[model samples]
Target: MVRKAKELNLKNNEDFALWKNFLENVGINNFSEEEVNQVDLTIGIFDKQKLLATGSLAGNILKYIAVSADSIGTGSNFNLIVSELIGKLALKGIFHTFVFTKPKYVTSFQHLGFKKLAVTEFGAVLERGFPDISTYLADIKQTENPVKKTAAIVMNANPFTLGHKFLVEQASQENDLVYVFVVATNAGLFATDERLKLVKQGTQHLSNVKVVSGGSYMVSYATFPAYFLDSPNDLIEYQTTLDALVFKNWIANYLHINTRYLGSEPLSRTTSIYNKILKKVLTPEISVKIINRRQLLNGEVISASNVRKKIAQNKLNELNELVPETTLKFIRENAAILKLRIKKGMKIRGN
Candidate 1:
């Protein structure tokens, strides 16, 4: 079971010692007693006799998301603790949440309504507005107005690549109508409108797929908390789980849509897990389909990260191999950013 940090008895020497042990075990050499004291709260997952995983929400930022060595791959325990924590936090009015993590972990946060943003080598950051569960549910309920099923594909489309085209195409095939939810927030590598334009251009062939921006009411930006870069999976599971519930209910009741299609890939954690939960919970009335991920090369995986890396390497030709010709052309024409990134890489190499 998991409980809030303030409720736990931590005045004992043993409690302090345990926290210290965890810090040292994780190689947090810079963590100070003062830092620990700064933690406003914490949530821990305990087994019959021991704490197996824990997360801390301190100074309005989530930190120390860690699982016991023995409890690494088992994602359930972690998710349970996180779910409890987030519920508590939400009730307390802590609506916006942020997390810093590797790009690969983006999907984990996605499940919770978090959208990933670019950051320095420290880590990738994901942010989402709070009470999203409620808002999402409201949206789903609104879906009832139209009987046809609808799926919203929230994308940043930096410059719609082939992978983006494939994902949209696959999504289109499975739904009656697809809403391409373009990120209007100024949180992408490219301007939101530019990115949206590329998506509109790339998906010109799909009439059923229309583009819409994540307008002011759609996302939480200026009010988000600090990024939880090192926190365990607890935060990811907790936040996203709520988001999925909201989205699910909204899709079922509001949109009158019962089915959603998503790409399948290791990078797609939120979609995969959300679908799993939705399939299990949504009555037979609603369904979810997991489509296989698209691959541009024979065996290589297609990913935005890989494309960015190629762009950094000035691999324009290779970029073509991964994206559509239209996307490639857009990227080539906007090569200044790519050039600047390359120069930055060279500076780092020189250093």
Candidate 2:
């Protein structure tokens, strides 16, 4: 007999509760609060009143998948569920998609069009069609945009501090071209649009730098959740490794990016772990540089975390010293709005 299935609105309390309970029963509880709310779409097969199988997508990345024990024998239900998700994405012109799953389900995902991009100790990151990347490369090769030596830096310059400037400046100086991918997801104190603008203003002085958005490809389950969730160490390492692998295997190849640059992370364990994984996963063809974190006059580290703390304690003057002049202007210009957001539970956790 065919199973009953339908799409769900997570904003609906009953649907949300059912989904959470289903995941809890299946022992798959590591996603962040943001992921829970940001689901682009979710569907589940139900038996009577019980949710029998379920899956969700957040910007082309498949996540929060679980199936009832009774449905685990074969790939029929699995194939149907994923095929529909891919269909949904395709309807909207999202041909390329990715999935992060524990190693046990890699075969199940492979049965559907997903190919293994990379596998880590905790999980395997897989993908279907990768769009745009190839087109970007083709456009470059066909014209004068052929950069001989290129570098990449994925940053969440939340407030665009002096430290961020130092890293971008260093990358611009060393590489013939630098692609600065600002994290595009709106999961920070300052919205992504503001962050993008700040990065552009801060890096405008660098003649060789070009700033771009990391559109659903940069921060995924790996480095992102570790910042907010009580994530397992294995997931933290694996997710981070996979993010770097995608860049080295795909983005680096497409845009002639031979180097990846990052500011040395001294405080955040998540960032430090991500930096370590990038170094190890990137091939010898691509160079990885971890610039030392910038510091202030009192010998203290110049950090976004410190900047956030100072703001919380009403130390605007001190924040000015740690960030670039551009960032300081942004903070002041949006002070009233910032207060409302921060007061309304917006967090300032270090990126």
Candidate 3:
């Protein structure tokens, strides 16, 4: 900013429209109502009368930031807002913070000691050190007798499906060992614990298949911001590449994984693109294979989203064709709970 703001403003709704408009000018549209409501703290840097630069922090993630085009060259307001956000976090004894921003802003954050944890063409996830990838990688319980040609699958089995089962079965049969890392992020319809349980029971028959929590390294808000945004594009590429990098640089080596398996995403465009990005990012040492999605007898592809839609629409019989017996059993066990969630009109992630 040529003329920086003197101080930050209090959290109020008066400046929200201003904030939203600013972010929109930068080609960003993911800021949702739920996320805005989650903001427990927001500080806008004002240039006396006008809001020149502003941002907010919630759940330790910095977001909803925008700056005037004129302020692009000046570091004054950028530095000011970041310092204020960090200071607020520090007051709470929070040493770590995460920032979700565009690729263009990575350098500004780097100057503030933030590490580039994940970046995609559309969005970049940077962290100030609240449990980075290395921290998550350290938590994995490697097999005692690690297999030489190990395969890995990172999935958020939002109730687990036959498609997921098929992928696991193939990986396990092909490789000496397979690690099924269930995504631990808490954004899905089912809680992480529930998802983990379902994934475990659904894939328990394969002795070579190890079902374990992804521990925040896979599809996590830390690496993928699209989890928060529904309409994601080009940015998914960078995020996926960063994901593969984490696996190649960290998880792959630790777990003796030379091959990462993925089911061909026939449903979500973003995921389909992400699969392509993984092809480019995964080094030659590690092979990535995209398996075809399992299909129903009617030829429709099986997906968790399809399973959820069936449950939501009360088409229980159709699910029999879309899901494995194990998943069907689990859904039956939790029928009432699933029904209640569906009735409440909760936005269940079918994917």
Best by TM-score: 2
What's the TM-score of every candidate structure? 0.51, 0.79, 0.77
Q: What is the C-alpha RMSD of each candidate to the true structure, in Å?
A: 12.3, 4.3, 4.6
lDDT per residue (tens digit) for residues 188-250 in model 1: 445677777888888989977867665432332222222333554444443344444444544
Per-residue lDDT of 323 in model 2:
88
* lDDT values for all models: 0.59, 0.76, 0.74
Comparing candidate 1 with candidate 2, which one achieves the higher lDDT?
2
> Per-residue alpha-carbon lDDT of model 2 for 1-351, expressed as tens digits?
557779988889898888887787778665567567657899997656666788888878787777777655435667777877888899999899878777788888888868886666566777788564555445434225667878888888877888888899888888788888888768788888998899999999998888877765665444333211234645567667767777777778767788888888778887788777778888588888888886777899987777877777778987877888888998888887887888999887757
- The reply for model 3, stretches above 4 Å from the true place, is 1-13, 17-40, 46-53, 66-80, 90-95, 102-104, 119-123, 141-146, 220-233, 253-256, 315-326
Worst 10 residues of 3 by lDDT: 221-230
Question: How do the residues 154-207 of candidate 3 rate in per-residue lDDT, one tens digit apiece?
Answer: 898887888888889999889888889998877766789988888888888998
Residue runs of model 1 more than 4 Å from their true location after superposition:
1-147, 216-233, 267-285, 341-351
